[model samples]
Target: MQQVFFRLLGPPEIYYNDQPIRIPRRRSRALLYYMVSTHTPQPRERLMNLLCGDMDDESARRAFKTMLAEVRSQLRNIDPSIEWITNDEDRLTFNPLAPIWLDTEIFEKATANRQSNLSLAIKLYRNNFLDGFFLKGSPDFDAWAQSTRDHFQRLYMLALQNMAEVYETNHQLEEAITCIHMLLTADPLSEDAHAHLMRLYWQTGDRTQALRQYERLGKVLAEEFSVQPLATTQELYRQIASNANTLTQPATPLDRTVHPPDPPLQATAETPVVEVRLPYVGRVRELNWLKDQLLGHEHERSMLMLRGEIGIGKTRLLQEMIEGYCTDWRILHATCQEAESKNHYHPLTEALRSELNRQDIGRLELYPVWRAQLERLVPDLFYTGATDNTVDAHHNYTGFEHISDSSATLLADALVALLNQLATPQHPILLLLDDVQWCDKGTLGLLAHLARYVHRREVFILLMYSPGSGEQRLAALRNNATRLGILAEVELEPLSRADIHELVTLFSQLNKPGDRRLHTIDRHISGDWCYQQSEGNPFYALAWLETVWDQPETFVPARIQEQVTIQLGQLSQNARHLLQLAACQQDSFDLAQLGSQLGFTLATTLDACTELITQRLVVADPVTTTSLYTFTHKTARTYITGSMNRIERHMLTQTASRIADPEAIS
Candidate 1:
């Protein structure tokens, strides 16, 4: 499936798996939006009037045909397989089941599965439908858009209100406070929202803020309608103020309380020790599944593909899962890298060298021929005096030598046999291949061979990769493994709200018995801030937590910047330039307008955006669609913008401003 995304929430956007296609002409965009919104057949005359109100039948008909053609052509340019618009001579309708991703559709369908989708629905309602967009002259279209926007706005408000109540019921005062604040932002006259927010502020131990919120509400009411807050709100405010007064008293002067400092003790033989372990959170199910396999009586080899976005904590989770079993299990871990992808068996060689010693396993009676093949990977088996013959230095593929098909098979068999030796009943093997997408074809060949014997062995294979960045390299292997039921993929998603809180709480109090923490005292507030900054990616969340709040620039450190640049390096010059320009805009920028300023054709812009979008560097700005796209991650934008020299950055920003009204620039 191409995975079509008809984004109608903020500003109109259409995506076919990261390829964003926009109808260049205003009338065409308007026509497409109308049809897509209605999803019903429209009489030819209705559309004609919308576009050419005063034209003769023939002239209007010609105009309508041309507009429709442009829309169809634009959609076709991104993906030809999907017919976005279908019509006969009579009327036009959207293909609803072009198998799409629409937030409105998701919200509608969430009724069937309320608890699970409600949170998603709430997240998707970032702003009013088409928050700032207007079809200035098309009155009918404007009316339709306005009504539709109101409908979604009402749904969003209702959803947020319900969410706030749920949070309050669960005693999540900070979360509830956030929801109520959003509710008021959208509907400022909401008395219930103000009341809930005031109560929530009190519940969270902010008595001063609670009283201040009441004042703010009073001001808003007076400004809006020259009226006071409801009697109920005033009474509640009085109750809070009464409690505050009761709790406050003149501070009794401390009795010159400079208690004599305790005499310094003599130094002991050993300094008081405080050992701190790195904090871990979430992934209960994934951890339990691996533990089940580890503790089971029978071992049916399990090949798990752990995939997620970068910094989603794949490696961290792996460490947590394997830590307790280390004493009994022979855990061998190797990380494949992009630079060494072409080096034959590089990952395996590293793993073998780590776990197997030449003086130990290598000296054993593996078949004479098998031992020789193993020697190629395990260098210390035979004393070569530095005359390494495993790779031909002269060959283009320098690190690994090619062998006959039979010999490659022998090498795979030899490694499998070696693993069998290392693996014992008491010590089952856990072979971890991190960054599997970077694994060489040679390693894949060995893995394919090993997979056959794995089903009966006491070994588990975990291949970890990021789905967005390098998945395309192993699509065929992943597909085959899926069909064979040999590979099970467990995706590690971002932490939930509850999970984020747990994570923040655990680490904030690390190595402190008295609950003296490195994080801010209000755990709930700190968790909320972390969620906003990191979006629950554990690595990012932890990074934000560790950073000084005022020095926010340190959150996305140099390593993350290097990794971001590595990803950008893989894109074409067009894509890189487009990304640099988009990054300069701070948030989303108009793709068509930005490209036109740089003399980039629509096709060129789409091609570049498609690459960035698919790689998860940029996305159709999901915050109230502005027909603009942004760097998908805040860190990516931070890195890219910070990479440019100040003069270059300023120049690019000016260039991006040109897109605000390309016509003005023209």
Candidate 2:
């Protein structure tokens, strides 16, 4: 028979062969109380103190020895062979290793079992810890005692409810009903317990009993708590009442319709940011080349220059590389926008601030920290502070002068210092500077300084620019950098028709067969259209598509006409006149001869070519130093020649004839 582990969260009691062992002497029980309550093996010295916490040391030790003798006599009645305690006097150790069961341990194990296996968890919590037991004022023992029972009761009730849910889900109506009954025994007023009982009653074809339980529960709540049954509780009661003969269909789905598939999302849906994945279009080969350049090169400080005309897709190439090719590298990007009319170093400021903020800068002083960087990008910025409304000392320091020659080097050093500080540890930095042509001289100088350390540090600098606009500055910088061994360039070409068609097919949602006319337009026009309208520039093509796509069904031709008219209206008078003269002549024309034919000054002709190129109406030989230009697209040439009036057209031909042979018109 196991001796019951007695605790005095209340007064002490014992069990032998599953029966209580009554011991009447209160002081003898106190000795047993101290030993059982504390698991630590108490020494003779500690036991003496427990027996008398405040008596003289000698008297306390004597009293504890006498109490131990009494406890041994009581234990002898259970069995003369039963030895209740063991002691190692040499080590001052006492240990109780007998087989005994404690209510607190039972309660805890039951709680754990309930979580792992509900049935066992429920059985273990069949009754409160030694029901009707009590111990006055040993607060530590009392709190531990009551807390264990309370936790067990809560867990047992929950276990019964969960078992009911599992049984109901499995259509085990009788078992589920039995589980709820067990729950009601423990907590007769648990609303959920009753509600689940009602559900089980209906499931088991006992609708009358289910309705009766509901009424009983409702009355209990109203009389005891002054509250009516919840709507769900009432609805469920009504369900059971109406369905007298029908047992709940066992095969019915227990859950509601599968939640609609969550909308496809990247990262958290609450964030407003969206990322665009650039498609691999016509630049597969260049992309491969770029991949090789980025991947095969292990050395840091490698630089790649993508040089092209304004609309020629330099930016797109870099965007593609970032999305598809350069996953292994850490890309930090800054784009120079034509919209920003502030100082040249403004782009650099935006870039620096974005990277710093992305790195989560916390409360940094601007004067020496950010100001030092600002000085490098705009040296004159250091000289001018708090000059304009845009320059608030606390928010920013922007009153600097234009970065002249004297401050350029100082600015470079500051920028280099800032970059060195910003670089993340152990990561290769790929600095992408798009539209480098638009970058101010100060920013350009900073980039030049960055290039100097590119080889030494773990950094790759990629710069994309238009040769027409940036060639001179780029050449000067490259020539200077060449002496230091860091100059390279790559050029982009127009996408072939097949590639353009494939891109439209892949990116645009419009059905190809349904919108054959538009498809035909795209097929015929996308190839040379960008070349002609945007000098084969990807940005212009994308922007132009945004304007012309999805024309109204009621006015398809009208939409096309409107678009053409809008673009024609935007043409400068000089470009319109020169385009008309070129239309009367041939597709390709010498600029000097065209100027003589139009009876316009060479400067006027040059300005007209500039307008056409700026508007992307024509393409010039990007490799040539001269102003030799041609119609960028067949449509532009055809539009001008086909739309010209007869009289103005004849005058253009005669002007061309006279400009070719001076004696003819004279």
Candidate 3:
């Protein structure tokens, strides 16, 4: 059994037994590309719609049959032993029974296994997926081809970026420079790549060339976005201009160790452990509002939903509430895990277990019925010693074993009673649930139940989750709370520019006072750039700051790319793909244009967009028409664009250029 080698990365080429086989006819080639690229059993109707969309239904069916026959004929000529097409009553698919190796598959595998096979991955990405294979008269197929091309291109570019980082880490300056230059060619607006090229030029004793790169960056930025280079980029330019000779020397790793003197000064008293505090910036009113709620009247139970994007600092606000305001309250915090979303009542169970561990309860004297009910949730809470004389000590835990079979309402009521028992007039109970989007259904239901009755008790519940997460459940919870008139929703907005500056200043004071890098960052950093790049999100800002703190000359795009990639990794595959396409267009794009470019129907595209909007990956442009959408942050667009492959980018540019000047294309 000879294996057929199919290459879709460059030209659509095939080989059997190490001999080249031509796949003749553009339609036949398109059919093969569609099947191999999607790697799914495509419905007959979908194939007809994509490949023969221009034809009438009857004619399209005839044309589709003819194309399939041609495809099979081509495959047979390549290798008679191979069965390439599998057609059922309603679907057509590539036959996996035949021995075959696809370059696209191999490239994807290598890129996915990037850590171990970086070099192989870079080498395997010979060209974009099905390069230059346009299907005339089939707009849908063309759009699909363009999207697939872009996907592989982005993967290849990522491999190159990774390779460049590896080379630079290994001190291969020339190789690293080459990779940076290649990246710039694919993504000219990559500020980090431009900065890297400049740095590499300076490191290799070409001050003149390094300076020229800065001029190039200025021109590009001015011409393209009508904005100046980022403050970090400008700072790098100034540093190189002022100390060209000093920078040309090989960069020495900073000495991070501090050695104690041989005869250290004698300590008269124990050194006080000064608690470092990150100055709570921007949410003064919100924080004060929460404090008021926490300190409200005894009969008032408050349920506050703190909603924001992933890095917008809802957790930090929760922390501030705990440390700065809710000192007198007994805090029980539990964060839901994505992997544990299916676990029944996980967050509540963990919170109860934590509370139980915090307060050593020898017996359940106060609420024996509640104890028996909660024991079903956390059985270890009811453990007793033989010598113990506390109330209910002689009662066997087996008596509550059937509590697991109790109704959800009964369990929720018992849990509420247990919470009430824990709360006192002297110390209120503050229940903090973080990442509530990942909360188990049972836990959410319990929270919803509690929300209705919490106002009657001395409890303050703070539920924090990214907006659009657990939409149906959260919406139902909110609606129920609203109907009861107890729900208080507080949206955590991104930090203002001034707030980010204050945050940076506070971070510097607490962590690295008088550090030269900190001084430089304070002096030259652009508040607008920071705000835009981080979307005023503190987590992303802090991550970027940490990267720059270590290497003051680190390019901004690289820092942003690292953070954005980490975020994108957390999204569903469909949402991530949609975001990538949205990013390829300008920051703001017409919704219809995106759907057309991605070859998605309006409904499918809208569904993906809804997910993206919910996750805050992209937001609807309120000022613009409802059909227009924009990324949550400019940095996200930069990261997405920077990650695109050359061919994918070229296709986009070509499409735009053709649209702009139809005559120019001819």
Candidate 4:
């Protein structure tokens, strides 16, 4: 399979396996270039006009025929085994599946994925299209080349501006300055770039240079456009001059840790490898508290409820605590997924089965009554004559959802007894249940039951869940545990800016030494941007870092976008669109009015709201009588709104506003 790649963001070039393929004749090369760039068949007349328009019609026809043969001959020079050209009567086309490569193909594909690849797209523009490459007596070809050159330059300039904005937002002043310089180099009369350069210099403490930039902008505008700099630029210059004595620069300047080694497009042979491990940062105190609860100073068992917002590092904290500090303890862990939330006692049964298979519980002399209930959950753990019904030796443990009230009691009691027998101070039992908000009703019940005896036995139960996930049964269990004086709720909070900084440092150090993009990343991605972009969530921080690693110039993580996409994907298309429209609002929206605007019944809207809330994508606020709905997180809402087209969003807002009065407050 010969895959073709094109690179035409600069001078035309074709290569495969690092070997350049050439078309000897200028007009023939232009024919191949035209086909690759436009991906369309060329008619005989069009090709003749494009390549030999100065000659007589009969002579042009003969010249075009000669050029077509030359092109076919040149195409075969690379690989004679392949049919690289297709001629159907009068149309000339490149074989679609031919082993051909083009630089322009690479540029277009890289840039097609939004701003995420703008940096790579910008780098591909090595020079103007077909720089200094022109054929004699081909006016149409020259005209096409000039037009293409302008088109590519405009794309390159736009990409540079986008990169500058992203860098500016991320507080990478130096990188932003470089982008501005690139833009000005391409279009010296750009007043906006000059103005930005002035402001950026002011931020960098180059006050005198900043003032000079304004003067430079004025001269350029007067020379090119016969006008003065815009009033806004003049105003900015005045402000900088007037406040020179008391101007305060931005905080967290480019320190040694946040500095770039070289500019963009520095040639290097080695692929930059950023080694990333599962990052664990700023949970020192929480880890200690958890360890203290599990490995009590007084040898008393503890049940700690680890709660936080989604992606606040609950699961990470649990893993760190267990793997880093509790190697001596017998650990049994089971994570609950949303799909398994209703499978009776699924999480608890998993944890028990895990530990039981590791150790011989038969030697502990478990009671026949308790063992019988245990056998239903764990395969092959029964005595000679346990329950009335004989147990299958190879029975798989799927919790019985239809067990009687008496049977439920025995099962719960049997679970607690088995845990008690297994737990000892010498080898404390650390039973970990992650994402307990997804636990079944039976698992929740058993957890609540287990919580009561936590202080009495040597077992430590750890429960992790998101507080805002709307798990009512889990909430009830939490309340009951609090009343019983057995649960110590440990709520994890988002990381601070300092913590984000530390995390980035940790990530950078783990990268392969001499990774050139290391400093480029350090300089651009300040802790401030990470803190603000991720809202101090480590999960999002890691996502941002990973995005930066792939595209050293990007700050918006596709991972986070993919997550939001997956979250939205769980809803019906109509429901997702409704949610996106709702996201256009800056505050809670009246559900009834929203439903009315979307032509949905109140009941149907209510069901949609319930689904969104259940997914934790939206939250319902209480009004006097009616409930208003809002997205749970501003980030998720922003993502949804940002994904919507500007015109669509505007129309949605206009339609919504027309249906309701703005001054109406609850």
TM-score of every candidate:
0.52, 0.44, 0.52, 0.50
Candidate 2 C-alpha error for residue 268, in Å: 28
Task: Order the numbered candidates by lDDT, best leading.
Answer: 4, 1, 3, 2
How many angstroms is residue 227 displaced in model 1 relative to the true structure, after the best TM-score fit? 99
Mark the regions of model 4 whose C-alpha exceeds 4 Å error after superposition. Answer: 1-275, 297-301, 380-396, 454-457, 468-470, 513-519, 549-556, 569-578, 585-635, 642-666
lDDT score of model 3?
0.66
> How many pairs collide in each candidate, listed in order?
3, 14, 0, 10
Q: Which residue pairs overlap in candidate 1's backbone? A: 10-624, 10-625, 11-625
lDDT of 4 by residue, 312-335 (tens): 777667667767777777777777
Residue 309 lDDT (model 3): 68
Query: Which segments of model 3 are wrong by more than 4 Å?
Result: 1-277, 358-363, 366-369, 385-406, 454-457, 508-516, 549-563, 570-574, 622-626, 645-666
Q: What is the alpha-carbon lDDT of model 2 when measured against the actual structure?
A: 0.56
List, residue by residue over 1-666, the lDDT tens digit for candidate 2.
556555432334577776777656544565565455434344565445434555687876676677777777767776666566766662122245655665435434444442356776666553764356543322333333343344445546666766777877788888888988887787777666777777777766777888899989988888998998766677777667777554342211122112122222121111111132335568777777777666665434356787765445565566667667555555666666544424656666555443343122222222122333353343322221111112221222343344333234435544554555545435556777676656666566767777885434456678776543334556666766667676556678877666655554554554345665456555554544534443444544454444444444222222223334444565678778887887666556676677666678878978877766665556775556676677665545655666778998888888877766779888
Error of 3 at 166 (Å): 68
Candidate 4 accuracy as TM-score: 0.50
Q: For model 1, what is the C-alpha lDDT against the true structure?
A: 0.66
Instruction: Please provide the root mean square deviation of candidate 3 (C-alpha atoms, Å).
Output: 28.3
lDDT against the true structure, per candidate, is 0.66, 0.56, 0.66, 0.67
